[model samples]
Target: MFAPTFNLNLTLRRAVLAALLAAGSSVAMADPLHYHVEIDTSQFSGAGFLDFAFLAGNSPAPGATATLSQFSGAFGALDSKEGNVSGSAPGTLVFGNGGGYNDWFQNVSLGGRFAFDIVFGGDFLGTNGNVGTTFSLGLLDQSASAYLGNPNGNLLQFDLMPLNGALPASIAASTYASIASISAVPEASEWMMLTGGLALIGFALRRRRVAALTA
Candidate 1:
C-alpha cells in the first residue's frame, strides 16, 4: 500500500512568519543630521566621488558633526566653492543622500539658484572673531555642472561664494566638514508591526482551512 503525503500548509505558515519577524525587527525611522560643504569653484565635475563612511550608533541630532578625510575631485583639483551649508530634503528619490538624512549631496542642478539656512553655535569663521554672520546663505546657486549620470537630479553643484554679497574670512576654511561617517540603529516598533501582520495572516489561513474541511 502507498503512503499518504503530509500537509504542506503548516510548513508554509511557519516560513512566512519567520520572514515577517525578521523584517519587522529592523524597522526604525532614521534620525537626520545635516552637514554643509561650500563649493569653492564656479563650476566643476565629479563631486560625488568623495569617499563616504558611516559609523554605527551615531545619533541624527544637532551638535553631532562628521569629519571628512579630504576633498578630491575628478579634475585633479579640489573643485569646490564656498557657501553656507545645511542639508537637502531627507528620504527623497531626487536630491537626497541615499540614506535617511537630508543633505543636498546628490542630483544637484547646475546654474540653478536656491536658498538655505545655517545654524552655528559660535563663530564659524574663527574662535577669536565675533562676526556674527547668522543669516540665510542667500543666492545659493549651482554655478556649474559636472556629470551626466542618474538624470538631472543626481548631478552635484555648489555656491560661487560663501555668502554671495561679500567673501567671508572663513571662505578659505570649510565652515562644515563632510560628516560622511555615521550610522543608525533599528527601533523595536518595526518588529512588532511585522509580527502582528504575520499573526493575522496565519489566523485567516487557518480559518479558511477549517471551513474547507467542514464543507
Candidate 2:
C-alpha cells in the first residue's frame, strides 16, 4: 500500500510539472504583428516644430499606448515617417537630427490636407534593446501650440495590436487609419532556463525514489 501511494504521488507531481511547462510556454508566445499607421494632419501645419514622433523598442508592458523614450538612446527598432504628403516639398522632414529627432507640419501638409506614413519604430541601442510582440505609437501636439505651429506638444497615444486584428487610428480632431501590429516573443534564454530547471527537478526526484527503494 505504501509503495503504491508513493508511486501515485510521483506520477501526480510529474503531471503537474508538465502542465505548468505547457502553460508557461503558451503564455509567452503570440507571433509578432505587422501594421500600417496612416494619419491625416491636413487641417493643420507644423512648420517650425515636429508634429509627431515615436519610441521604437518593444516594452515589458505593451497594451494600447505608445511607450515613451528618449530620441538618442534605444534599439530593436527606429520610429520613422516617410516623405512629405503636403503636395510639394522635398527633404523637409528631419529624423534624429540637430542631435536626435525632429519633424513638422510642413513635412506632412498637402495644400489643405495633411497625410503621412510612419513606422512607429523605437531606437533599441541603450541599456534596453529588449523586444516584445506589440507596438507603442505616439503623436505630437505642437511646439506648445496647435491648429498650426512649428512644433507639437501634447502626445496622443495608442497601443495598436495583433497582426490579423483591426488597424488602430489616431489624431485629436483629424482622421487616422491603422492595421494592427507587434514584434515580441519569448527569448531562447528563457527556454533554456526552464529546461535546466525541469532537468534538475527530475534528477532530484529520481534520486529520492532510489533511496526509498534501497531502504
Candidate 3:
C-alpha cells in the first residue's frame, strides 16, 4: 500500500514540476516586444547611417539594451529623392538605414506615409532609466548601398521616449508627433517556450503511465 502511495506522490510531484516549468517559460517568453513604425525619406537624397541608441530618461549616455545576440530588428522600405531605401512593397524586409545627407528628408518626412517595425527584449526597459523605451530610425548619407545600424550620418530621423514602463495599445503607439507606431505582435520565443513546456508535460505523463502498468 505504501509502495502505491509513494508512486502516486512521485507522480504528483512531477505534475507540479511540469506546471512550474510552464509558468517559468511564460515569464521568460514575455519580455520580447514588437512595435510597428513608418517613415518616408523621399523628400531628400544622398547617403547616411542610423545614429541613435537607447537612452536614459534625459541623459545622453547609452541605456540598457537586450542581452540576446539579436539585439534589435529593423524592417522597412521607402522611396527617396536622390536614391531610395530599396525593398519589395508592402514593406517586409530587413530595412536598411540610409537615405539623404543635409536633413532634407527630416524636414519633409516627419509625419507622412511610411512603415517599419521595431523589435527587442521588452525587459530592457525596466532599468537604466527605462532606456529601451527610447527608439530611433534615421537616414544618414552613405556613398554606396545604404546598410542598417551604422549611426551618426543622420539625414532624417525619428524617435519615441519614456515608454519603458509599459507599452500601451494604440495610445502610446501614436503619442509621437512624427511617425506613428501602429500595432504590436508576438514573434517566436513565446511560442517556442509553450511548445517545450507542453512536450515536457507529455513526456512526464507517459512515464507515469508506463510505471503504473509495470508496477
For candidate 3, lDDT tens digit of each residue in 1-215?
12364665576676666656644553342433465554443443444333332222343322323111121223233333222122232323222212222111221222124454555433233333332133334444454344322333322222333233454211133332232234454456645655665676676667667667776
RMSD of each: 16.3, 15.3, 11.8
- Output the number of the lDDT-best candidate: 3
Report how far residue 22 has shifted in candidate 3, in Å.
Answer: 4.3
In model 1, the runs with Cα more than 4 Å from the true position are 1-48, 51-145, 148-188
RMSD to native, candidate 1? 16.3
Order of candidate numbers by lDDT, starting with the best: 3, 2, 1
Q: On TM-score, who's better, 2 or 3?
A: 3
lDDT of 1 at 80: 36
TM-score leader: 3
- Give model 2's TM-score versus the native structure: 0.25
Output candidate 3 Cα RMSD. 11.8
Clashes of 3: 15
Tens-digit per-residue lDDT, 147-206, candidate 1: 222222322322111121333322211223121112322335655666666776676567
